[model samples]
Target: MRITRMLGAAALLFGLTVTPAVADASPSPSASGDDSAPTSAGTSFRTATEVDQGQRATASASTGDYLYWSFPADAGQRPTVRATVKLPATHAAQTWQVDVYDGLRRRQSCQYGAQTRTAEQGSATVELACVLRTVRAWSEPWANDPLPGTYYIRLTALNLTTADLGQPVNASVRVGSKDIGGSAAVDGSLAKPLVPGIAVSSQSDSEDGDTSKAAVLSSIEPDGGWTSGWWSDRWVWTGIGAVLAALAGIGGYALTRGSGRPSRVPPGA
Candidate 1:
């Protein structure tokens, strides 16, 4: 009974240490917005218009112009960008494409979607969508896994007729996200999303200055810097390690303990 009680106590300690570390996490507050969001698109990444998830931004642009918009993404999110271009009636077919990039400026590959499409000469509009991989809490220094950060969506004409150059068109883009919950949770996170330019703002201090000019041409970091994430798998691992250590100590005591240790006496004594 005493040995059973010791085992029970060890099991109870393990449960307490491991469960809360993985279960008590709360995601950061997401950026919010309505349908009609941005009024214009940025000419360059430095000036990309800020848009929140579920918000749509539209602007009048030329066929070959690069239109840009940016949004915040958090860990465990799979963000999908959808774009529509209403081209003016033309005699030549046109190819349009939408590309997404992480805050590091590395172009992220779409999981699957109509990222590029050709609009028939008489077609009224061309639609494009790019689905990004789930945002990870952390990735290897060399790995390009999509981590939480500001993501950019660029819309442009890939192959348009020479005569269609400078032709006016209407462009719109929208962003949405699906959370992966605790399934994709990890033991680590970035100190900050790969956004450049602005100083890493702390909760106490707001910001530094426009330092990203040389790096990103423009900084589109979130209003407040990203939080380093709330929960981690390290807690669970640590608890498990402690439980093993304690169990080892208990087992060693049980095995090594005997009737008594001889004092200066012979075995026969």
Candidate 2:
């Protein structure tokens, strides 16, 4: 009876001690709101590999033309979108704009800025950056907050010189994200995979059977597979730790009971 009582006490003690430790060790979800981190990277639109966010690809565009790229983002992650446009010395000064949109095709307002004429020799470089805020889509119907999913970036050449018409201007873009303190509890798997946006001019190429032209404008690939909430991966490790702790407690209890037993005496004595 004493051994049984000791075993019961051991189990209870473990449950009281390890359970709270596990809970404390787990990360707590952040409150829903605009929890964006300070962004250092300037924004610009550039062609990049589907899997890589560092490598960039260059594209040439004429006046009044647009370039589009899509990137995946999760709630609580502050994603920064940037693009850089280089104008040749031969061309006159021009103005460009970068707009960000949500998965639902709704234009999301973001802080945008640009720096031009930073280079010498009459060449101009434009840099733009937008830092997104955390969004809770289900609760806030009136607010146009940024949510987790695929986001589209449209780069338009607002003002181009007449001499630069038909001349291709080089541009590059990249998207980066960092985890701010929060959790995307409301977000889940998307019903349909998000598709990358295509340039307006490239739309007619498909109908005209011009595969090459369409391919050029459709170079941006879809953002890879969906990512679960921040706590998803942590839960897995917590479960494994709990199981191991329970096994250790049981082994300790068994050894304690064995040690409490009286030693046997020899018959010859």
Give every collision pair in model 1.
46-218, 197-212
Per-prediction TM-score, please?
Answer: 0.67, 0.50
* Candidate 2 displacement at residue 183 in angstroms: 6.4
Q: Write the per-residue lDDT of candidate 2 for residues 1-269, one digit (tens) a residue.
A: 65477557656755765564455333223322322321122233334223223334346666567676666665445666677877766766666677777766678776444522233336667776776665332335575767655666777665555776776667776666555432434544433223344443346565786655543322333234344343433454456567667766876777677666569877886
Stretches of model 2 off by over 4 angstroms after superposition: 1-55, 112-121, 135-139, 183-224, 228-269
lDDT of each residue in 1-269, candidate 1, tens digit only: 55677788888878877566445344334435554577799988888898877677889988889999888887766788989998897647998989999988789999999999999878999899998998888888899889888888899997667899999999988887775555667778887666644334332144445443334433444334464455545546666787778887887787688647765777775
lDDT for residue 73 in candidate 1, whole number 0-100: 83
* Winning candidate number (lDDT): 1
